[model samples]
Target chain A: MGGGKEARRGDVLLSGEGLVRRYDDATVVDVDSIEVRTGEVLAVLGPNGAGKSTLLRLLAALEAPEDGRLLYRGRAVGRDDPELRRTVAAVLQRPYLWRGTVAGNVEFALKARRLSASERRERVRQALQMVDIVDLADVPVDTLSGGEAQRVALARALAVEPEILFLDEPTADLDVSVRRRLLGDLERIVRHAAPAIVLVTHDPGEAFALADRVVVMEGGRIVQAGTPAEIFESPATEFVASFTGAEFMLNGTVSKVDEGTMTVRLESGASLEAAGSAEPGARVRVGYRPEDVVVSLPQSSSTSARNRFDTTVAHLHPRGGLVRLRLEADSLSLEAVITRHAMEELGLQVGTSVVAQVKATALHVFPA
Target chain B: MDVLVDAARQALALLLSGDPYLWGIIARSLQVSGSAVALGLLVGIPIGTWLGLTRFPGRGIAVALVNTGLALPPVVVGLFVYLLLSRQGPFGELGWLYTTSAMIAAQVVLAAPYVAAITLAAVQAVPPELRLQARALGAGRWQALLLHLREARLSLMAAVAAGFGAVISEVGAVMMVGGNVHGETRVITTAIVLETRRGQFATAMALGLILLAIAFAANAFITRVQQAAPRRRRPLTS
Candidate 1:
């Protein structure tokens, strides 16, 4: 199932081709293509206005796409098809629990599928236990706190034993501690339940922690989709790189290519060599981690370092025990982090000359 | 003051003596209005839910029409019902005019719009997410609709109280449509009007008291149903 691109066409459980959803004149969701197959946790990762929730709604069959076919199990299904709804359940960011007891909320799914009385009770008990909220089963929904309510909502969806589970920012409203615990529970659920999950969240950390495959979206369109390692280590777009906190980005043109390495001349007039297949004359975005660039004084020049730039410490911003130095050259702007001891020992300050060393392999060069 | 005191005493005497005529009128009032409210509920709830939840081009207009109907004058409703059931009118051939059925019909006309509009508001007040949540749980459309109505049970029951209140206390519409016939269409409100016109102030006042008592009782009952923990400690079915 984790064969990446090959899994995409093998057993596509749900797919949307050329899907478009508009609210008035504003297009809220525009997916040229997307698919969720069985046994994979797909994370739609984006910011608040990135239409992640809207895309989840579209895939859950809760909404009708204005310009696409929502194929379920390889057959075209109507947006109002009751059968389709039964196969999938969604827990929205701020889910509305029916005005009832916790058990009743979970029982709702059982009721909808017309399960027998004893069976409903059994399923409700199992679902509540699974979410670790069985003790709150008989408690009124209004009495439950946010975390408890979210757990009950999860139980409600899980009670259905759906083939697909759509959790739209499930822990977006939880406290930090609660969110962490719920994330652990969610991962465990994915492992034990074995249902295809589409978790929608703007938190990249959450996506990387939970999802098997990550789809990065921006401004209502999916910009990148890959494994979490691929996304975090070598983001395909500048937005993905910035979102992942590997924040350094520079516009550069490839000047030379020899073997597997390419020389890129930045707009700032600094040259960097990176191992990439990009052809010469290609405009590309180069990104690297702040910690990847080793900051030291000019006297301690490391000869073995291949990509070393002599730059000045423009400013220092202290963060706890680490000092963030904003570096500047004639045309390059970069930020690097070093310990306070290093700052004290090197006597680095504004306008101080320093050599920034970065390994060529750490530079992520992608065609812009 | 002495005259008023005497009328009150006389009213108590008329009440204690169990006047068959007065009791009969009270019974007729209950039957007609109860039947009307029932009929209204049977037709209004589904329509109101549809009107409240659906998003079509003319939905706002339909909702506006229902809201406007909430303020419809009883006399106007009576006049229309009378015309519709009049011999020369289109539905006049049913021969229900000037009968108890016509009184019930008029009361239903007064009550239905009130019920529908209030139910619409009640159902709308239930958060939109409730339905979405219900559907996400695999509920069919009808089940989801019922769940919304259930969540708004208090308000929907209040709609019933409003509907019954409007129909039970109305005189103008029933008078025009049923002609206030004795031993037939002489409900409490119509009888009160008739007795008052004939200068029987005590009897009219007595009927008014009974009518108020009935309304208070009905509302009390509806309130109990509304306020009582609508969801039982255990689900009634499962």
Candidate 2:
């Protein structure tokens, strides 16, 4: 599950081939192929308006594709297929709750399936307990807070015990702390319920945290799909790199090529060793995560990191639980995130001179 | 001023003593208007909900046409009903002119558009995502539509109240079609008109007060239903 191209866990529960959706004159979703296997979480990650939500709608059968074949369990199906409706459930960013008690809203899913009263009550109770909102079952949805309302929405979806769950930014509108808590609960539920889930969100952290495999979309097409580590470690395009939070970028020219490694002379006149295939005299952009960088005082003992740059701390931003150091070496700038304890131990301050180190393996080189 | 005081006293006596004639007129008014509004709701709500949810090339014009019906003159509707049921008219063989059925037909025409236009507004006021969410939660098409209508139930009730208020208080259409027959067709409004024309100011005033009371009660009911909708609370930040 951690490898990008590893064998997936279960059989294909749903698949869409050559899906295309258009609105007015703009094509919002155009995918050649996609599949959702049983007991796996597939995340569609992208920036805003990248068609991730649209693609989820297409797969959820909330909207039909203009041209495509949608197959559920190898059988062709339309949006109105009773099998699809019976087996699938979805929760959206906005908690579109009904005008009723939380339990009443949760029971709606069971009622729609024509479950008996006892079954509905038991399922509704269990679903509310799963989301840890059992006490709010009888509370009116309108009186509940946003986070609580969203929990009711999730409970409603889970009450059906669907085989496939579609979540479109369920926590997007929640507060950070509330969202974190909901994500934790959702993660546990996914592990316990083990339903095939398709999660659509612009938040990379959410995808990395929940998804077994991710499909990054851009401009109405799936640009890349892989495991979380693969997506974070080796992005296929610059868009993926930047969108995945690869913040440290440096422009350089290849000065020498040896074996499989290349030496790049940066525009700041700092030569660095990186592992990539490139001919001499090619301009390239090198990207790395801020967490990969190690910063130290100039008088420190030597470290084994291959590429080092003497930089000045230009700006210090205190992020939650960490300090982001904006370091500048002549015209080349790089950001490094370290714990607040490390910053205090090093006595780092703005305008302090430090040496930033990066291993050659951590750098990703792209043709400029 | 003297005539007003005398009429107020006489009106209270007639109302308190349970004058059968006045009571009968009130009953007939409620029966005719209630039936008209009920029939109107049966025909109007579905069309209004459909118009609200559906999108077609001429939808704007259709909505505009429904809204235009909201302003339809009761007298013109009365004339139209009269022509359709006249001796020389198409439905003259049934001879429904100057009858309660003809009056009901005219009021239905008056009330349906009123119901439809308001119902359309009410259905449209509900967020479209609610329908989508209902479908995503495993509801069939009719089930989803029912959920949406349930969400708009308060407004739909207000539509009924408004429709009743419009048709029950109306005199022109019912008078033209029912001919204000003494024992059968003389509703509250038509009876008030007759009393006023015959210089019976006290009876007219008595009947007018009863009509106003009925209108006030319907309006009060509408207000309560409208305000019964839960108020949105401030969103929690944490």
Candidate 3:
């Protein structure tokens, strides 16, 4: 078993190479290639109708591909292969409980494998305890709260002790607090169980917090795939940049370069320094997180930073504790996230001229 | 109006007198209809479940045919069964004509399609996600089928009840096939016909009332069974 574990760890547990599933003229899933490595959580993030759920279904073998193949453990598997089926489990967006007590749903998968009655009972107990719903075991499944039902569904999947777990919007309908708790519990379980998890979610924070790597899908194909940090820091395309909420895009010419840092002169005549290696004359697209740009009243005798510009506030949108100030300087439009306290102290309003100060390390520059 | 009231009073007296002939007819009706419903359920449920679960060529046509069977007239079925089971007919050598067996056989034909069509609709009503979830949990196709059937059991019971109701009340096929023999083949409906034709209005009216009561009782029993059966739960042991 140890040798088998090592061999399996090196093997790709789930692989979809050139998978294509189309409905009439609409393609639901068109993947060039995607692989879930052993014990890794790969979150597939996309907007609604972006084919994330469809990809999970294709991986789970619930649906057949119109074209291409899905392989498990270096062998081809269709929707009917018993060995492949045993190694994979999925929690759908809306889980169904078989008519029975909560204990019954959890025990179903174990019983399917023909485990002894004692073994099945033990497994079901462990699963129920893992999801913190052992007390609800005797309760009828239909009477469970939404969160409780979802937990039972998760427990049912875990009872199988699968090698791969697919979660398609597991927390899509859950409230924020419940979602956080479940996600945290799930992260712990995935770490301990060491199953390759493929989570499809629309929540950016959930993806960033739980996934070791994130794959962004749009219109039935993968747009980008990388570590969350890599994807967030330097998005490969405009779509990724925008989808990940790195929304502000500025075109500029490099004015100065020093040690992997470049000061860019925007077309709006504002100067911004970014952490990138670029020649002095190269044109580049510079981006920044809204939170990275600070808005404040003009300060005299301040330390000279690489990027600072005085701009009029075009819009002030308050969101929670943060206020997003859309500032305009000539043709340059930048968004800065300031605290409500800061906004109040600075007496900021739309059309009020203020200094939009940005840290050089906070800006990301990519060649045009 | 006086004569109608006198006839109704006479009918009530005959019914209260516990006539042996009327009891015999009632017994025969129970025997044939009960056997028919059992046979129909045995054959129809599995076929309906299979048809609903498995995707095959001509599946739509098959379902359509079964749904069409739901509206099949009893007289037409009686004619068809009579042609097949009568002397000089294809099955004449079996010596099954004008007997309880022939009645049961005819009623089975009438009831089977009712069972099949209702069970099909019941199975189809189960959400596809439930099947997908079962499959994802490493359940084989057979296991998924069992789970889906368990989930749809209530509706399936209602289908069975409908089929039972259909078989129990049907008279055309049994009359045509059984030949209404005096003791052996004479059932409630045929006996009623015989008494009415003989101008034994009291006995006929009494048999008619008893038959209506039997039908009502059978339906009430089925409904109570349906209501008493445990609500569908995802089966733990399957």
Number of the predicted model whose TM-score against the real structure is largest: 2
Order of the predicted models by TM-score, top scorer first:
2, 3, 1
Tens-place lDDT digits, model 2, residues B1-238: 8989999899988888998888898899899999999999998898899899999999999889888888889999999999999999999998999888899999999899888988898899999999899899889999999999999999999899989999999989999999999989999899998999998887888899988998998899889987785765555553
Report how far residue A367 has shifted in candidate 2, in Å.
Answer: 2.5
- Give the Å error, residue B91, model 1: 4.2
Q: How far does residue A170 in candidate 3 sit from its true spot (Å)?
A: 0.6
DockQ of each: 0.40, 0.61, 0.44
Residue pairs in candidate 2 whose N, alpha carbon or C atoms collide under 3 angstroms:
none
For lDDT, candidate 1 versus 3, the one ahead is: 1
Best DockQ goes to which candidate?
2
| CA shift of A149, model 3, Å | 1.2
Candidate 2 scores a chain A TM-score of 0.94
> Model 1 segments beyond 4 Å from truth?
A1-10, A277-284, A294-303, A309-333, A337-356, A366-368, B1-19, B87-93, B213-238
True contacts kept of 3: 0.65
lDDT (tens digit, per residue) of candidate 1 on A1-368: 33343224237778888889999999999999998887788999998999999999899888888998788776788668766887888888786888879998899878878899999999999999999998988898876777788899999998898878999999987777888888899878875553588999999988998888999999999999999988987788878888887755568899999998889998878898887778789999888878778988888887788788888999999998999888887777778989999999999989899988888888888787
How close to the true structure is residue A258 of candidate 2, measured as C-alpha lDDT?
92
Residue by residue across B72-154, what tens digits does model 1's lDDT show?
A: 89899888888899999899899999998988888877788888987888888888988888887788888888888889888
TM-score, one value per model: 0.87, 0.95, 0.88
Q: What is the lDDT of residue A237 in candidate 3?
A: 70
* Candidate 3 to native Cα RMSD, angstroms: 4.3
lDDT at A320, model 3: 91
Tell me how far the alpha carbon of residue A336 in candidate 1 is from the true structure, in angstroms, after superposition. 4.0
